[model samples]
Target: MTEPMRISIVLVDDHPVVRDGLRGMLESAGDLAVVGEASDGPAAVELVARTDPDVVLMDLRMPGGSGVDAITELTRRRIRGHVLVLTTYDTDRDIMAALEAGATGYLLKDARREELFAGVRATARGESVLSPSVATRVVSRVRADTTELSDREGEVLRLVARGRSNREIARTLFVSEATVKTHLTHVYEKLGVGDRAAAVAVAYERRLLGD
Candidate 1:
């Protein structure tokens, strides 16, 4: 039987030792190959263009530019390589930004060698693999519990949760009733609810309205 083709990868991180360690770890898997290494975003983009690897192990906060920017640029340039974020950051902003910029997967640096290897292979296969912590953040953010809701919408939802009528909410917020209705419409749409009570319930459940 023919041997399976190796998955080529490019390592992008500012720290030389981290890169070396990762290269060693990945190469230990018989079907994996580290084809090139870059210490920053610009170099990473260039190296990726040259090597055309199956996957890119990207660090989020690097010099020259961030991994988010690199991923966006690569997407804009239409590079075929999938990017997998391997970094210490698991914040809502960092996770959302990397994913929004087209990263195929997000894994924390604390992942075991086997997990890292599996993540890279999954990423190369167009599968998304998020670390457990990262997955939680993503799920929470998707529930509309985050800053994704505009301030005005949030304020409207808060008043609604307090059992305030549209007119009462408008009076409390100092906005016109028409404006309050518009804001509530937006809130309901964002929260994926059909009415005021449902929107208020979702907001509270998602902790969008602080306890």
Candidate 2:
């Protein structure tokens, strides 16, 4: 029988001790391998592109840089954006930022070793893995909001999620910049978000921007 391939991963965290622990814990799983490690966002981006691992196990709120920024950088560089955030933060802001930045999974640091192992594997397979707590919060928000984004507003927001500026979005949609801003304002009202970042985050939550 052919051997099953191990899921390749890169660990990114500011703390050496945490990275070390993750490396040992993950490698012990027998079906996973840590191919690289980085202590900060910039290093993490370079390492991920060079290594081309199956999954990236990232930590948010690193002092060197944030995992959200790293994820956005990876997406901007057109790297294989399969990032799984493993951090202590379970806040709504943290979760939404990571998701809008292109993370495939979110696992709290409190996850069991086995759960982390499974989360990495699931992330490698292009699955969305959210811890129970994160899942609850996401669900609650989704249920709380039923107002929908209009088709034009949704289109504008989708372009926003792709990192397009107002001018760029306007040009692409053949509309004036003022028109684009108006659509965005309506979107913000409907989504109950203040800015583009928060709007994109909530759009993903409501599944308005489909994968």
Candidate 3:
């Protein structure tokens, strides 16, 4: 019988020690291999493009660009591999942004070795995996908000999530700043959030905005 293919992985973390630790943990599994490594977002993108690994073990707050930025670029390029975020952050904003950027899974750095291993394998199989705490946060938010936003509200929130000011959003959408604020107010109400940051957080968690 032909040998089963080993799962190829690329590690992306700013710390060499962290990368070394993960490499040791992941490569212990006979079916998994660490094919490449990158210390920042730009290098991660370039490495992924060249190696085309089965999964990318990504870090969020790297120097060149964030993990979210890398994921967004990879999605734009239609890369075939999956991105699995492995980091210390599990805040609502962090989780939502990475997931919205097309990450296949999010696992905290503190996860048990077996869990991390399993999450990576699941991600490679096109499954969405979340750390337990992250799963809880997402489930709670998604269950509470069932009201879908109007197209304009979604557009407003998308710009907000991208860090655009109200005036900037108005200019981009060809609307007045007051109109932009009005749309944002409605978006906040619909998503049950009180402010711009919270609205973007919930919108991303609920997938109300296009990636």
Per-residue lDDT of candidate 2, residues 178-197 (tens digit): 99999999988887779999
TM-score leaderboard ranking:
1, 3, 2
lDDT of 3 by residue, 1-211 (tens): 9888999999999999999999999989878999999999999999999999999999999887799999999989999989999999988889989999999999999999899989999999989999999999888667565588888887888889899999999999999999998998888777777998898777777677756
Off by over 4 Å in 2: 147-211
Lowest-sum lDDT 10-residue window in model 1: 140-149
Error of model 3, residue 51, in angstroms: 0.2
Candidate 2: minimum summed lDDT over ten consecutive residues — where? 140-149
Report the lDDT tens digits of candidate 1 across residue range 36-115.
99999989999999999999999999867789989999988988879999999999999999999999999999999889
**Whole-structure CA lDDT of model 1:** 0.90
By TM-score, how accurate is candidate 1? 0.72
Candidate with better lDDT, 1 vs 2: 2
